[model samples]
Target: MPLNCGIVGLPNVGKSTIFNALTSAKAQAANYPFCTIDPNTGIVTVPDERLSKISALIVPKSLVPTTMEFIDIAGLVEGASKGEGLGNQFLGHIRATDAICHVVRCFDDPEVVHVAGAINPLHDIDIINTELLLADLETVEKRSQRVEKLARNTQDAKIKTEASAVAKLKATLEAGKPARAADLTDDERTASRELFLITAKPQLYVANVDEAGLANGNAYTEAVEKRAAEENSQVVRICGALEAEIAQLDPPERTEFLESVGLHEPGLDRLIHSAYRLLDLITYFTAGVQEVRAWTIRRGTKAPGAAGVIHSDFERGFIKADCYACEDLFKYGSEQAVKEKGLLRSEGKDYTVKDGDILFFKFNV
Candidate 1:
């Protein structure tokens, strides 16, 4: 239930800097390799304007926003799969995460050191991805070896299928492709999941640019974006140092700084939103005068499953949910007006919670 994304890249790609900006935490951003030995975990509030709008109408004494966790993982290096330079430890941290934020350096500054000697965003991407694929290839090969041994001794169809699955995975990984790009059937995919391949996790690219490159991307950012498009991944442009400065300012001052920089909002917000989507997550609300709060759930989750996010008992005593759209309330100016127009309705356990839904649960327990 505690889903998180691991920020990963080579050394000094602004991974820690962007993380520091996102969480405003002092996680140590030194211009050197392996500065972050252990992954630094930080919880950040997921921004949603609907939460404030819902609070305004309901007049809650306290309002709470849902959060996502970000893990600033140690930088990966070439030959990481061969146990090079704290690679195994960092790769383990990445495996624990649900998704990945692959940070790429799209800026050049004399003060920051580049791990690859020069900026080649494509080569940087290839290095990190190759390491992950190599790691997964080893895992698949090992799993395949064990499964093949089992296959020769038994006539179990399931075991044979598993062996075949790992065979396919091995071939894909051997061909320098991630396990996700492998052509697997349903059973094969299920079998592949058991390996917990690092390459299988969904990912988005973060182009850490300078202040000038933020508004209009530079050549480096363009390269990163093009590479992301080729891989069918998303790219989020962020100026790490500037965002760190913006994060320290007061809300009023932050707004002023943004306007002065020709930005309507912080780039971190875009990064957060992109990561949320990469995880296939959605937010729903529970409204009341006591506390209006937002909750996170996977897309296409049923009402009972969503209720389970709050507490087991809510899901145990399953019932209907009274739900309305936050946008409807905003349009109508009040919840009463929304209800008067029949915008509110009761939904059964089969109801699929939406991103902007305001739900009121009806449970016996």
Candidate 2:
């Protein structure tokens, strides 16, 4: 999976608004549909409280936070799969992303026009989901025809495996299920990954609520929660307008603003943290008196793969790493204390990394 998420939803649902708040970039947010023609890509820093504590101790020359990309895609309307309202064009952009953040407008505003005529999250969700399903269905059916031809001529096991995989995908799509809904073996999954089907990507719902619903949530948000529960998806309720303003504040003022709202941190932090978890991403740290930095890796990443994310040379060296969990530092009060307590240890190439790990790599140039 790509280490990024794509923002998708109907037009005028504050998709661009939330995108701007998340990235701190001004993508045009207007009252009309299809304002975002091309997708806007932004890199957002992943916030970690542990990074702050590490920084306090290390006092590095500069601090660089780990980041994830978010792409703001154009709106999708009804009949999008059949080429309605720039449907195919937008769908192509979504397919390129690793995950999807579906923005639903839960706040009612007469000024900002609703493309669907009213605020109905379930209806809006159906419009986008149906289009994606249709697009994937078309792809599966087309591939199925070609695969059947190969299956007839070839006796090779690989060809037969692909043929069977495509047939299975076709059956699922025919039954109005997504390609992800189909069961496939490890080999079949490897073959299917080449297709990069949009419906196969994991998704989370983002309910953009008004200020009144930001804390406890309102009726529209309640409806979204119910629908998300049925789909086995997660929903995050936030006020995009409020977040935009908070993004512009200075650090001190930002803290005060959050306090006034009875929040210890911005909602965007929770959104970012949730997105990280939703992607099954984990963080590992490189710490020292010289520098302390956070790195992102997949949950099951081994030592070498995690090292490669920092630099290819680190992986090429293929040496051992001095590692300890960040919690050990917090618990024991310092690296020296942790070392004395026997919390620090050496890990080899096959070692699987854990979240909040503090690593010191020993390698020859």
Candidate 3:
């Protein structure tokens, strides 16, 4: 399954607007709280210039780009963890995603109402973070109740280790820190995945600014950037209203509109790529006469693991991969040129796939 990033923020923070623009899907972008109660999911193609570049060289019949899922989760209110304003339902939706895109309202328009009666990006971030932390604290506390007994009464080493990990997580949450903030060992981190704490997922902040703010970030965006810097998180600034308008245009018109706005590319493209990188995702390609296709995998995926992304049978019967860096192809201008320079490699099962590798997996079922 493709990994997903959940769009979340307080009500009327342009989460739906950004989602609609990102996917070109008509999610209800009304001017009120909880406009989107149910999550709206859209599959977005990860844009890669290399796909077309490789296609140009291979002259393939078809070109397919890999896709990632984006889910527009309902706006989270202040007391969402306590079942306020469908908060429980929304939190569940967020917990299911691989990553989070926290959209913060950085633009001011008196015409549109703010849920908190004013715009304060830092305050808004704190409210959402507190709720998520509280929700995770509750989860850990409840799990501890059962595990504590097992650890103390039984001689099972696994249960004792889990109990200790749970205790560490609880302490961190109680201290108003996210679950990801806790220092965990590799084994504990792997085990904590089963807990599925919402705060443990990677996150990026989206600053929804006005047209003017897009060029030079406003005070609100500056505040967001400061907070993100302190947390070591990434912040992406975009004009939600303008992106919505751009999303409605045709291809030619969109190009013209972007040029008119003095932007080389739509901000949504930058936002998408930022979110993709936030998840530690990398793209590899399979170049063939039949097709030139892009594929998504984690950064350090081995040959068999990368093959498993294409097909389970391929991984089960994996041999080796005939691979060449896309850069070599671009530099040498042809497969024959790359071969002559010995840039192509036959990789074994233990080979870790690189981002722009053009691979042809050799397998026997």
Candidate maximizing TM-score: 3
- Clashes by residue pair, model 3: none
lDDT at 234, model 2: 86
Backbone clash tally (model 3): 0
Per-residue lDDT for 1-365 in model 3, tens only? 89999999999999999899989999998899988999999999887889999999999989999999999999899899999999999999999999999999999899889999999999999999999999999999999999998899998877877888898999999989899899887777876888999999999999999999998899999999999998889999999999999999998999999999889888989988998999999999998899999999999999999998999998999999999999999999999999999989999999999999999999999
Computed on alpha carbons, the lDDT of every model, listed in order, comes to: 0.91, 0.88, 0.93
Instruction: Pick out the ten consecutive residues of candidate 3 with the lowest summed lDDT.
Output: 184-193
Q: What digit string (tens of lDDT, one per residue) describes model 1 on residues 90-168?
A: 8899999999999999888888889889988989999999999988888888788799999999999889989998888
Report how far residue 120 has shifted in candidate 3, in Å.
0.6
What does the lDDT come to for candidate 3?
A: 0.93
Worst 10 residues of 1 by lDDT: 187-196
Give the top-scoring candidate (lDDT): 3
Candidate 3 lDDT for residue 165: 87
Model 2 off-target regions past 4 Å?
A: none
